[model samples]
Target: RKQLVYSSCRAESAGKALADVMPDETVHNILLTASLCMGFSAFSYEFMPTGDARRFNYIAMAMTGFCTIGYVSMYNGVGVIEVRGHDVFWMRYLDWAVSTETFLLGLAMLSGADRWDTIFILAMDAIGVLCALVGALIPAVVAPAYLLGAVVFAAYNYRLFGTMQVSADRMGAAVSAKYKRLTTQSMAAWCVYPVVYLFCEMTRALDETTEVALYACCDVIAKCVCCFLLLSQP
Candidate 1:
């Protein structure tokens, strides 16, 4: 369904002037797919009562959708160790997507977290994202920065996940249970992302196909399943 939406939207945009002038226009397809998903999640929000977790879930969907748009160019693990593909793969405005979504998710989780807790998560994720972004854009020259960002991201990502678990305990029963499931499961599922990134970039153990597949699995579990779980809450 996601691919279908991406393809259709990509096709429609192919004839427009931007498509004609821009290089490798198909990469923009992710934005279309994400927008469609965001709209669907927004529409689905109406099914839940006012002020439910579904509202935040809808925002998460949008965040996931929009943030993934930056893929300067996807690296398939089969071959090529060129430097161009690594750093700052934000041709499609990845900086915007990641930074915004990090902010959005931290903000949304505030429904269940204390101000200090939420701010801490936001600060770490923001710093991590910025560092990671810088690292991604310039892996060769500023590899240390990227590595540091990855450390910040990997270390703090788990911390932020734990915060969600703690927050879940304090919320009302319905919200608590859902947040618990969402946070715990999301943390575990995403365990594969960092590993995939590191091994793919370093050892080349997995082909690009496997790398993408792992990422897709993580996304479906983290975003899609979590959204539905939130929708089903109460």
Candidate 2:
């Protein structure tokens, strides 16, 4: 039934321009450029000298690497599904699932979090992303799923600022400061996603162009800018 609906929608839009059926050409171009930039940046991490902090480079690579693939898929007009009248970019959710886990892993490593703490936090993040993905796909479940994702996000932040912050402090003043900065910046960038989803996917308050631009900007900040900051830290 779902496939039938998607096919019918595509068939109906066949008479329309390509942008009307899929993503706008400019947005697709931007996605392609962003993917290439992230791919190159991830590759450049290979030359960094190995050490205790070098592991963070690996985490950054994974985050950007996944995003690179996701954006490239989007550029190629793949991984997008039509639900109702809206185009849902499912690949972004997949990218977030992996990238956010590696992101939290880097933070956990910096804070010296125990294995259990790390596992628990990663689980919460995964559940939150899953909830968001479900909400995007199913119109009826949007409210409940959004609320659930928001709650899970809150819980993740609690653990991050509570236990993770404490552990970072124990590491030393420098580690603690760096951890706080990265966490705060990343969290702020993450908060934009739910807002974008609410407006673009659920409420339809924003148009597709705005949605793509906002998401693209947020991805750059969260993955590229934050990863650069993390790698540049002494």
Best by TM-score: 2
Candidate 1 lDDT by residue in tens digits, 98-182: 5345533633464466676666656666675565445545556345754665676666556555765566666777666666565
lDDT scores in order: 0.51, 0.87
Q: What local lDDT does model 2 show for residue 211? A: 87
TM-score of each: 0.59, 0.88
Residue by residue across 51-155, what tens digits does model 2's lDDT show?
767788898899999999999888877788888878888988998999999999999998998888898899999999999899989989999999999999999
For each predicted model, how many residue pairs clash, with residues at least 3 apart or on different chains?
5, 0
Off by over 4 Å in 2: 1-22, 48-51
